[model samples]
Target: MSLSLFIKYIHLFALGLLGCYLLRYYGDLNPVLASVLCGLLFSFLPFQSFIKSTKGQGAIYAGTFAAMSSSRVLNSINDFVLVCILGGLILTLFEGRFEGLGGRKGMIAFLAVAAFYMYRSVL
Candidate 1:
């Protein structure tokens, strides 16, 4: 990736982890509500760059889904962070492949979580 794109990816990854943290620990701890709140927050962000970057949005949304994972599925905050990063990378890789398909974001999130589990068990 180009230098700018790599930096943007890092930024998205951090935002994704933040989204996961907020969803998992914030008041009420409701994934649906937290995701909606995040969506709303993104909608109102003053930065046009974020508003226009679908990948950034997808990364955050994927992290929201990742946070929805149970403690049984993801043992610790470190695991959550890793899974969210995996999710963001998967989301970036799968971008445009599922364009116009609803729920692709959720699928990408699921893939990330599942991949982490599988990876853990295999090695």
Candidate 2:
């Protein structure tokens, strides 16, 4: 597979695992906010160089946040803005809750996004 595709798959897998973790622990969190917190933590964490040396981790987090909020608003512009807002809210709500689990947060964010998409499609 091409490098980009490979990276995307890996990111997707990471998100899936994150979702499982969230389900196991903090599934009660609002999906949109959880995704934002996950994205922010993943982006800012200094462990990028030690493992998975790619900026895609940040993208995965951001994408998950976006996906989670995509269902609430239909307008494309509004959707993007809402995603960011939701993410921020999540970060604020669960501040310092998962200090050492950036990866787990990412998975939860992914699951939230997936759940949003699933709900949107079903309705």
Writing each residue's lDDT as its tens digit, candidate 1 over 1-123 gives: 244553455456556556655765656667778767776676577765753577767666666666576668777766766776676567556656978889887787788889988988888
lDDT scores of the candidates, listed in order: 0.67, 0.46
lDDT tens readout by residue for model 2, 27-92 = 656666666566556657665452243435543554454444333443354334333433333433
> Which regions of candidate 1 are displaced past 4 Å?
1-10
Candidate 1 structure, TM-score to reference: 0.76
* Candidate 1 lDDT for residue 69: 68
| Collision pairs in model 1 | none
